[model samples]
Target: MKNLLIIILAALLYTIATGNTAAQEMGDKEKMKIFTNWIGRWEGEGSMQMGPGEPRKSKVDERVEAKLDGMVLLVEGVGKAQDASKQEIVVHHALAVLSYDKNTEQYKFRSYLKDGRSTDAWIKPTGENTFQWGFDIPGRGKTRYSIVLDPVKKTWDETGEFSQDGNTWMKFFSMHLTKTE
Candidate 1:
């Protein structure tokens, strides 16, 4: 009985120590440039291909703030239809962000919707001013977003793709945003 108790205690200690190490590593900050440039106010218009014959347009407002706690960044965003009827037809959408882990060296995107569900994304820069972010949904589907920022034009281009086979991509939404003062 004493030997069994010692074995169990050792296993518990091993698990706890491994878990703590992983958590500590995740909290470190790594990517700095990506977070700094993304900090600002942005506004744009977006369109979604709901179906072959169904398409919708909406306005997008995004705000990114630098967090004082280490290398963390906060983001807030809202999307609403321009037309009253369209607005009434669909559900409200909004997002609140806490912090981004720089140690992972990946752009992390998350949003809390009005429907009480939260979505998260991991992003990576593909080019100088281009980045890709993707999210996975358990039973529904997965979406990958590509964004491009033009400093001279002060505009942003975004495209969203949905995948089923994980390799095939289909356009789900597209947006063009102009920076707002």
Candidate 2:
């Protein structure tokens, strides 16, 4: 009876000591750590031009979260602005997902607009906390967005640019956001 109890206690201790080692070994992707500072709720202001129209001012709200056991970063943003009739309306709404592909060793970005448009684009870290992501349209040319994250200041500045020849670029969108949570 004593020997059996000792064996049982030893097995229990071993199990406790090695708890979830497989999961720990296959932990979150190290590359995704670059986006840690961006995981939060943010609010700010922004301006955008539609077609050839003037820029419209809007209030921006963004929420970024890590999901799927840290396999992906999900981002959602909404912009509210006054229309020409002076009525507040949803000017922009977008949701995006960022993930790292271990096999290809590349980052994949998928962004969707409120109007049922979506684009799968390439995304990569440009600097310590800066990243660029974008896709090319069939005929409209190429559109790219760059985001600079200042973790110290908890500020996020993003810009959108378009290029026709993939050389000459024009800026058409921008936003400045501060982390609120």
Candidate 3:
């Protein structure tokens, strides 16, 4: 009788553990579907601060490709000011590679430049197609990044900004991305 009670208790423990593991696995898989539509080619325009009086507005072309490894995505693009002549101004270039975390339901963005420096940020989703992400770098200061996605119209708006105090954010530039084949 004692051995039988021990066996029953062991079986119950095994069942509970298996059930919990299965539930966690399904939750991770469910998260992958939430970010599916963001994978594609897009183009956008926005403004950036060049100096106290010189605010430069530019257009960026980005292509987001989804990798099969754990809901990861890579964003690569180039940006240039609308009115600046290549000879008169230095090139403002950016390359970003980022990944999504299913457990945290967040996106981690890291951007590398030609100068060999990189900036990392954490992105949080606030709405169905909207997200806010920001971070501070050595020289760039505190920056806030936000994105708004319109699935029905297949459009997206993105903004990047810097805050002196980190509480109030000012927009340096905004981009309207339209999906094109």
Candidate 4:
């Protein structure tokens, strides 16, 4: 009777350990799929509000790819628009990495710009097809960026907004992207 009890306990422990390992692997793969959907070259048009004047129209291109065995997504974006004076074309470049955090159970974003500016934001899933990344801007309130993916249309729509009171949002930029490959 004692031998049988020991064998049963050992079997239960093995099952529990293997089950948790399998679940964790499956969870990671599922999370990876969410980011892999954005992997491809995208071209689009966008507009940005740089100053007090009107928003300037711009040409935008972005590329996203899975890295680190699908553990992270690397994104690169370029925007070309006329300057405030409309005298020359202004180019803006940015790079970003999106990764899932197991401890936080959420995704994190780290972005770097050509002007040597960088931002770290937390990502939230707002809807079935939409995700929002946001950060507090100290005295400026908050800034949020949202992206909606349309799988059927193979398009990505993104918007940037700022809120002084955290209740009223003012849009400052918008982009519409179509997958190129």
Question: Any residue pairs clashing in model 3, and if so which?
Answer: 46-174, 47-172, 47-173
Tens digit of per-residue lDDT, candidate 1, span 54-127: 67777788777777643566767677775655443333466656455645545566767778888777777888
- Pairs with backbone N, CA or C atoms under 3 Å apart (clashes), candidate 1: 30-102, 30-103
Error of 3 at 124 (Å): 0.6
Task: Indicate the TM-score of model 3.
Answer: 0.72
Judge candidate 1 against the unseen true structure and give its global Cα lDDT, from 0 to 1.
Answer: 0.73
Off by over 4 Å in 1: 1-30, 82-92, 96-107
TM-score, cand. 1 vs. native: 0.71
Clashing pairs in model 4, backbone N/Cα/C closer than 3 A: none
Error of 2 at 48 (Å): 1.1
Clashing pairs counted in every model? 2, 0, 3, 0
Alpha-carbon shift of residue 172 in model 2 (angstroms): 0.3
**Number of the top-ranking candidate, with TM-score as the measure:** 2
lDDT (10s digit) by residue, model 4, range 1-181: 9999999999999999999988986787688676665889999998889669978778898999888778889999998876668754647799999988877887889999999989898887777778899888877799999999987899999999999999999999899999998
Q: Write the per-residue lDDT of candidate 2 for residues 23-125, one digit (tens) a residue.
A: 5435536778888888999999998876877788899999999998787999999999987798899989999999887677788999999999999999988
lDDT to native, each model: 0.73, 0.90, 0.73, 0.87
Q: Model 3 scores what on Cα lDDT?
A: 0.73
lDDT of 3 by residue, 1-181 (tens): 9999999999999999999988866676466556666778887665677558866766767777777544566777666653434543324666776665655666678887777978788777788888887787666469887888888888878888887777787777777888874
RMSD of each: 8.0, 5.0, 4.6, 3.8
